[model samples]
Target: MFALYITHPQVRIDPDVAVPKWGLSDIGSARARLAAESAWAGQLRRIISSNEVKAIETANILASASGVPVEIVEGMHENDRSATGFLPPPEFEMAADWFFAHPHDSFRGWERAIDAQTRIVSKVEAILAEHDPQAPIAFIGHGGVGTLLKCHIAGRPIARQGDQPAGGGNLFCFDLANRAISCDWTPMESWKGESRKG
Candidate 1:
């Protein structure tokens, strides 16, 4: 079986709002549309996404075209950073640095990398076990969480990080039977000038 792990480009996070759960921005929505178009136009058998508006919106678009209904998976939601929501950019950066420095532990209210890895990998494993080995599955998630999940699937150290550029998208294909990342973070060039990883 093949699985396509994906992520939403960007969400409309209200900088002024203390808790930002804003929907996708104009550009973000565009990127998501393109991502969906690319995946649905290809070989994805099913679509899964986090319940967040941004991811759901993207998944719905693909589902509409693919003639399949979306399955909202709670475990696929973005890594929670509730403990440090709405910090100024600089403070957020500093906190993120600290979080990365200690991946096994949570910084503030954010998810511990180990916990996130466990949940994501477990959920994905269960899904893979249920699907036909010849079919492909797609997931729409957040950038950071998506990259971390990819690392887990690749058998890389959980503490290591990957690029997660803003307004970018990644496509990874996992071959279930062989336990291989058949493909990793293939850049979608339809939307030019944007880095695929942050």
Candidate 2:
């Protein structure tokens, strides 16, 4: 069987509030709706989401459609950029580049990419350890850590190439039994939920 790893869609950018508290924009909600109605969405037996509002909202949308409950999973948040606060897109992109380029080093007090990767890997592995792999599942989270998890499962080095395309709301899939990534990031609305023989 395969499990989906989904990144929350576009958020209502609020320069005034903490980033994690940001919720989905109208467009994001619509996209989430489309994804929820996707044929593959019905295959999901459970949804696990990061505690961030955006992720939870996305998971809730999908969960409602799948007739499953959304389970909040702590420690699955985006890389800690709260230390530096919000940066304009250009500056933020540059910092993100540095963050990936130097996975072992902190960029301006932000969490080291390697550390974040380790944390995500540990938490996901723990989840897998406890879950029954007979059914498919989805993990709703942020792009940074989702990419980190992708890279780890693919046995690739930490790099931005694994990151989702601009605008978020994307997903990847991996085999639940063997922990091998089977797909790269695809927009949630467009993905067909490719089948896995497992």
Candidate 3:
């Protein structure tokens, strides 16, 4: 069995809206629909999602095909960026770079990258601890913390090098029995449940 960590695709970015409340854009919803029809989505026995709207929307789309309920987990959110609210694209990218570069330090009052990594890893471990090894599961979340979790799984230090592709809607898989990474990031619609390398 395998456990997949999936990142939500593009979202409707509204400066006035709280980041956590942002929903999927049209493209994101379409991508989720495509992924929902994949073999991997059909094989999922459990679908866990972050409470964020975008994540929940992605999880629901994937779950619709399998009829599995989306389990919204509280602490599976993205690295807290509420401190700076919304930054323009270039500035946001720079801030993100700094966030990864200095994992132990906060970027403009944002949550420290190290702390976010710890939170995501702990949440994932707790979920896996109670999960059935015989069943396949999917966790839907954001890019930042998802990368953090990937770093922990790969036994590497946190770095932006491990982040998903620009558009998101990607996933990586790990073995359920040993929690070893079985696949690197792949577009969700194209994965087909195959496991390659970390």
Best by lDDT: 3
Clashing residue pairs for model 1: 1-133, 12-23, 163-198, 164-198, 165-197, 165-198
For residues 155-184, write the lDDT of model 2, one tens digit per residue: 999999888999999999999988877888
Model 1 CA RMSD to the hidden true structure, in angstroms: 4.8
* Per-residue lDDT value at 124 in model 1: 77
Candidate 2 TM-score, true structure as reference: 0.97
**Candidates' TM-scores?**
0.83, 0.97, 0.97
Candidate 1 lDDT over 1-198, as tens digits, reads: 566677766566686654325577787777666755654335557888887777787777666657777899877776787776677767876776776667887887798877777777788778777877766678777766677788877777654356455454556666657767766576542422212221
Can you tell me which runs of candidate 3 are displaced by over 4 Å? 195-198
Off by over 4 Å in 2: none
lDDT of each: 0.68, 0.92, 0.93
Superposed on all Cα atoms, the candidates' RMSDs to the truth, in angstroms, are: 4.8, 0.9, 1.9
- Give the 10-residue window scoring lowest on summed lDDT in candidate 3: 189-198
